[model samples]
Target: MAKFFKYKTTADLEAENARLNLDLRFSDDLSPLSQPVTVGTRTVGNRWCIHPMEGCDGNLDGTPGELTFRRYQRFGGGGAKLIWGEACAVNDEGRANPRQIALNPRTRDEFAKLVEQTRQAHRDSLGDDSDLLFGLQLTHSGRYSVKPIIATHDPLLDPRTVVNKATGQKVTADYPIITDDELKRLVDDYVATAKLAVEVGFDFLDVKQCHRYLLNELLGARNRPGPYGGSFENRTRLAREIFTALKAVVPSNVLLATRMNGFDSIPYHKGDNDDGQPDPWTAPLANGWGMSESDPFTPDLAEPIRWVQEMRTLGVDLVNVALGNPYAQPHFGRPFEYPPPDGYESPEHPLTGVDRHFKCAEAVQRANPGLAIVGTGYSYLQEFFPQAGAANVRDGRITFVGVGRASLAQPDWVKQLQDNGKMDRKRVCRTFSYCTALMREKNHPLGQYPTGCPPFDKEAYGEIWKEVLELKVKK
Candidate 1:
C-alpha cells in the first residue's frame, strides 16, 4: 500500500518522494503556476487547468439541468484559466448515458445560456475574464452507446459480449458494426456541433478521442474492413476530415483540440494473483492504440508523435493525455486507492500509474514542443500535487497540470494555492472512488443521477450515497 500520500509535512513528503527516486519539489511563491501561457491567438491567465468531468445529470433532451449548471459554475469559480468542459454527445443515438448532454437544435439555446452562466460566475468570483478559456468536449460514444441505433462492434473491444455471472461463461452477441456511411454522417454531426459550440461563445471545441470513444476506437481499428480502418492513414482519416470540415465552418478564432488516450495497458483480473497483478496470457495484444504492437505494457509513441505533428498542421491547440479506458483498464487512467464496484484491485502502485502518465506527457511534450500537452493522473498526489505539478511545469515536461477528480473533491484548491501556497490536508482528495462508483451505478440508460463530490458536498451526493447503501443492505 502507498504510504507517501499520508504524510502531513513537506519534509516527510519530500523524504518519501526521494526514497521513491521521484524529483518532486514545492515553492512558496508559486510563480511558475501563476505564469501566463499563450495558445493559438489567445492568452490564458495561468497554468492550472480543470479537466472535463461529467455530471451525468442533464435533462432527457440533453440540456443542462440545474446540477450540470452548478458543476460548471463552481469549476469556473475555482480559478483554472483553462476549463475543459465535460463531454457532450453530438447526437441522441451516440450518447453514452441517457442523461449525457447533447448539443443539438433543441438544446443549443440552453447550452449557450449555460456557457454565459459559467463565464459570468467566473467573472463574479475572480473579477476578470480576460485570460479565461473554456472548451466544450464533443463526443460520440460508439461502442458504449446506450442506444442501439449507432453502436460499434470492434473485435478487440466487443468480442465475447455475453458472460454468465454464475458460471462465468463467455458468449457472443449479434450486434451490427457501424458502417462507413454512418461515419461520414458522424463527420457532419461533428462539424455542425462545432459550429454550434462556436456560436454558443466557447473559446474552443474538443473532438474528444479519449476513454475509448468512437474516434479513439477508430484509431485502433486494425481488423475492420473499410476505408476508415486497417492502415494508419485509413484509421486517422476521420479525425483529419473532421478537422478540415470544422475549420471550414467555424471562425479562425475558434481553436480545435482533442483529449486523447496516449497509452494503454493489458487487462487484469482479480484472481490473476494474490497481489492483484495481471494474469499471464498467450493471447496477443488487442488492436489498442498507443501501445507497442509487440509489448502491450510499453508505450509506442511513434504514431502519437506523428499524430501530434499532424495536429499542429491542422491548427489543433493542444492534446490532454489520458491513458487507457476506465471500463477495461481503470488503474492506468485513474489512480485510486479504492476501486469502483465493478473494478478489480490495482495491479500496480498508484505512484507507478502516476509516473507512467508523467513519462507519457514528457515524451509527447519533448517530441512536439509547439503543441501544448496537459498531463493527468496527478490528483492521487493529494496535497503534494502542487509540489510535483510545479516541478513539471518549471522543467517544461508538460504545459498544464490537469485536475479531474480533485476539482470535485476540492473545487477551491486552486484558490487555496493562490492564497497561501498550501492546502488544507483535510480537503484534499483521498481517492475514495465514491464518484466513480456512483457513476457506474447510475450509468443505466434511464437513470438520471447527479455526479459531484459526495464527501465535500454532502447535502446532495452524500444523501444519495446513503440511499444507495440502504438499498445494497436490503439486497
Candidate 2:
C-alpha cells in the first residue's frame, strides 16, 4: 500500500535516513569488507557471508537434488569467503517439508560430494579455497514442521500452526507438544549429524536456533514444565547440551556456531487494507525468546546477551544474529518491498525494520566482543548494503555482512564488489519477496516448489515461477 524504496543515489538514501533519525551509516571505503578476519582457528577470506539460503529442492530421500547442487555451486563460485549451508533436518519427522535435506548414513556420500564440489568450484573461480569457510546448519522445524512438532502452546501461534496441510487444519489447544524425553533423544540425533558433518568435510556445524525451529522454540518454552523449558537455564539447556556434545566428539578445529534469534516479536495478522497488524495479546507474554514479557512489542536483550556469553564458554566461535519468527512476522527478519501471497503487507516503513536489525545486532556484538557476529537484514538496502556493511565492520559493530534473499538474487555479489567496486545495478535485489512467495507454494508434486529469484535468476526460476502462477490460477 505504501512505496518505500525510491532513492536514486546515496545522497537521497542519506536524506531519508536523516529524516527517519536512524543510526544507519555508510562508507565509500569498502576496504574493510575485503579484509580477512579470523573465525575460530581459520581466517575467512572476507567479511561477506552467504546466509544459509535453502531452495527446498532436495530429494525425498534427503539427498541434494540437481537444483540443490546448482545453488551451492553458484555460491561456491560467487566469491563469498564464508558459505553457510542451508538447513538439513536432524531426522525425517523433524523436516519442515518432505524435500528438506537431512544428513544421515545413506546420504553421507552425497553431502560429502556437495562439500567437495563447492570447494572445487571456489578453487576454480578464485584460484584458491584455503580461505573459504563452509558450514552446515542443522535444525528441526518444530511448529513449522510437516507434522508440527511444537515445543509449547501459545495462544497466538497455536492457531496458526498447520496440523494438516491438505485441509489447512490448524493446531488446537489440546494438540500435544514434543515431550522432554523426545528432546533428549533429539540431542543424540544432532550429535550423530555433527559427526557426519565433520566426516563430510564441513568446517563448522550450526546447531540452528533461529526462525522458531525446534531448538529456537525451546528457547522460549517458558510454560512447559521440564528440564528443557521454564527458566533461562532450562530454556537454553538443549542448545548448550548439543554444543557441549559436539565439542567432545568433533575435532577442536571444527567450529561450533549458531544462527540465533535476537528477538522473537509477537505474531502479526492481516488487518485493515491487508496490512500487517500485531495479533491481540496480554502483557507478560508466555513465549518469546528475546522479547519483553511485559510489552511484547519491544525487545529485551538481557537474555540474548547472556546466552551469547554462555555460548563463548561452550566454544562457540561464530554467532549469526537474526530476529522474528518468519512464519508469524516475515517482515521482522527480512525487510521486503512486497509480501508473500500468504503474508500481509509490512505494517511500518521497511527502513524501520532494517534499523531494528542493525541496532539489535550491534547490542549483541558489543556485548560479546570475542565472538564473530554476522549481521542480518541488509538485502533490503539494495545497492547501498555494501556501504552500510562496510561502515558496520569499520565501526566494530559486526564481523560479517550476511545476506540471504540478496544472495539468491546475486550469488556473485562478492566478486562484483571486488572487480567492479560496486554491485551491478540491474542484478541488485529489490526485496520483491517473489522468493518467499515461491517458498509458500506447496502444491507441487515434490511437496514444495524450489525458491530462487525469478526476477534475476530467470534461467533457473523463471519457468518455476510460471508454474506457480498457473497453479495459483487453478486454485
Top TM-score prediction, candidate number: 2
lDDT score of model 2? 0.92
Write the residue-wise lDDT of candidate 1 on 1-475 in tens digits.
Answer: 3333567666776776677776555554467888889888888898888999888889888999888888888888888899999899988888888889999888999999989988998898899987999999999887667743323344444542333334644334565677888888888999888888999999998988877778888887666677988788987888899988888897878788899888755555565443355545444554667876568778887887788788888889878988988877788899888776777777776777888889888889999876678999889888788877888888889899899999888887888887866776677888888888778675235584667778877866788777766766876
Candidate 2, run of 10 with poorest lDDT: 291-300
Instruction: Write the residue-wise lDDT of candidate 2 on 139-214 in tens digits.
Output: 9999988899999998889988889877989999889988888988988999999999999999999999998888
Clashes of 1: 0
What residue pairs clash in candidate 2, if any at all?
none
Q: Model 1 — which ten-residue stretch has the worst lDDT?
A: 156-165
TM for candidate 2 is: 0.99
